[model samples]
Target: MHVVQAALVAFGVVFVAELGDKTQLLALGFGARHSLRRVALGLTLGYGAAGLIAVVVGAVLGAAFPQRPIEIVGGLVFIAFAVLSLRRDDDEEDDDHSGLSVGRLAMSSVIASIALTILIAEMGDKTQIATAALAARSNPVGTWIGATLGEVSSGMVGAAAGSVVGDRIPPSVLRWLSAALFALFGVSMLLGFP
Candidate 1:
């Protein structure tokens, strides 16, 4: 695939994967309670690290699987992500910590907390897995860059919205949009968009 196409595909898929995700909600909460810049920076760094690792693994896997099969698998994975996103349970307890202060705002505690929380929350996440799959089928560098940007953008948007709007958007809308995007990508990839 072309580098631009690879990057675009990874960006779109990963962006959609992040909507209404647990990490996004965390970013929202962090934004409400802490500095948005620190939260965004931490999210960017953590997501970049995750994207790098996932892309590396995908590149390794690419060496093992041929292009055609990898593309097919990536498509299937997108579809599965769509289903999972639509079916996700939203009844989980909120872990809001607005009452707890981790020290002065100038300290690195905020960054550390956001980074650690995101890193742990993103383990085996759909976006990470999708980044790996995209790398396997396309350019690993493009996939990594795109996925990293997508994750950062998602975090920033979520944080900004959450801080300003306080989750006024309905979760169902995000789910439907995510599902549609995943299905569209999956179908196009399966049918060979190129």
Candidate 2:
């Protein structure tokens, strides 16, 4: 695929994956308590760092393995992601920030805290894994850029809309949509559709 096409595909995949995710909820919570600018900046930094790591590892793995085998594995991984997405509980509580007091932190501290929290929370998250898988099959640089942008954009939606977003869009709907997309991608890859 062309680099731009890869990036666009990655963006769509990651963006849909992030909708109704816990990290987006975190962004909503922080947005309710802090400035949107800070929340956005923090999310951008954290997602960028995580995306960089994912793509680099994926690039290395892609280079190390034969292309056909890698595509097959990537397809399986995407199918697994679809199953996992369906299995996620939509009613799960967002209690990750129970201990932190955002009011007491300075501006820079708030940004750092948010960034660190996201980085830690997303280290092994499905989005990161999906990003890695995408990089393994597509253009690593494109995947990195698109995944990072997708993550940031979804986070920004939560931050901008706050709790209103939660009230409007059902998490289950997003989950089902995301699962379908993953399944489609997996099936396409497995069948060598592209």
Candidate 3:
């Protein structure tokens, strides 16, 4: 039951954090410009790397700070990100693409870009704190597996759709939904939702 709850929470948080994110746009743009499968590869690998880093950071911080303190910080930070999401982006996320090639370059460059973008974007985010909280409530393996699966699953869907749709979705609606989801998570964490 706890595991189930953790998985659900993990999926919800990561999925919400991903919508309207830079990495999501990157995935979409890369998908449209390149092979969807290849783009998925790059994006998945990138997101995996970032998630690993986040897990490690979450573990360390979870140890250093009490759960509530870290959660408070994370919730506050995510609120800021949510607020930013509510506004028009100064530069649309899909504005540029770095030159990418095949073989090693494809794996290295594409994956690296995705990983870096997501990592920077998610630093001190509610997603990370949720991962930590889930870890506390569930077994380590369960938490890790749930986190990995949740993020990768959502990422694949986003990458596939982003590649084909590529900004086809209504921008205003996406932003509003993203902001609402993020803010909901913040409030839930701070207030300890029932």
**Which candidate achieves the best lDDT against the true structure?**
2
User: For candidate 3, lDDT tens digit of each residue in 6-26?
Assistant: 666666777776666544654
lDDT of 2: 0.72
**lDDT accuracy of residue 173 in candidate 2:** 65
- Measured on C-alpha atoms, candidate 3 has an lDDT of 0.57
**lDDT value for model 1:** 0.69
Candidate 2: where are CA atoms >4 Å away?
Answer: 58-105, 163-194
TM-score of each candidate structure, all chains considered together: 0.60, 0.60, 0.53
Candidate 3 backbone overlaps, count = 1
lDDT scores of the candidates, listed in order: 0.69, 0.72, 0.57
lDDT of 2 by residue, 1-194 (tens): 67887789889999999999767866775565456767888999889988887888744644576656645665676677668657654223323343445432445566776686566446556788899998888888888889999999999898887645445666676567656766775676678653
User: In model 1, which runs have C-alpha deviations exceeding 4 angstroms?
Assistant: 58-106, 165-194
Instruction: Name the better of 1 and 3 by lDDT.
Output: 1
lDDT, residue 100, candidate 1: 39
> What's the distance in Å from true for residue 114, model 1?
0.9
